[model samples]
Target: MTDTFLIGMLVLAAGLFAVGLFGVLARRAVLFQLLSLEVMLSGPSLAFVAAGARHGDPAGQGMFVLVLILAAAEVALGLALYLRMARTADVTDSDSIRDLRH
Candidate 1:
């Protein structure tokens, strides 16, 4: 691919990351925040893959795999906590979950 392709990928990745960040910060819903966090994570994965391809290095692919594992674990744990909070505390509101700071 050409430099233009690389730049385009980078721009797309940045856009995705920014949108995800905004969603996380602006939304009060826990599920939406989790999804946004996933989107944010994907942005860097795209950048790393693009860079690895551009440089003909395998490290980028390896890093992406690690990120995928991390994302999976995050989703699993986040959902578990969300469910626990919803069931035990009857809480869906983030502000009400301040007891978690303990």
Candidate 2:
């Protein structure tokens, strides 16, 4: 792997992360936020893979696996919360659910 390739990969990772951050902050819908969160997670995952490939190290790949596990857990928990919120009340906007207590 060349330096230019590494730089490009890093830039791409940054872009993915930034887009995800924008989605999470700009959108209020729970589903969109979840999707954005996944995108955000991907940024680091890609970075880890790229770096690992560049350095010929397995640690980066290991980290990527951990991130994947984290992302999966987060999705499961987030969806459960979203479903619960949806059943109890309107879940169009996140602000409305400020107080989970019914």
- lDDT of each residue in 1-102, candidate 2, tens digit only: 899999999999999999999999999999999999999999999999999999999999999999999999999999999998898786757878786556
RMSD in Å for all candidates: 1.8, 1.5
Per-residue accuracy of model 1 over 10-30 as CA lDDT, tens digit each:
999999999999989998889
lDDT of 2: 0.95
User: Per-residue error at 25 for model 2, in Å?
Assistant: 0.3
lDDT of 2 at 82: 92
Model 2, position 18, has a per-residue lDDT of 99
Best by TM-score: 2
Task: Mark the regions of model 1 whose C-alpha exceeds 4 Å error after superposition.
Answer: 99-102
Task: Quote each prediction's TM-score.
Answer: 0.90, 0.93
Report how far off residue 72 is in candidate 1 (Å): 0.9
How accurate locally is residue 49 in candidate 2, as Cα lDDT from 0 to 100? 98
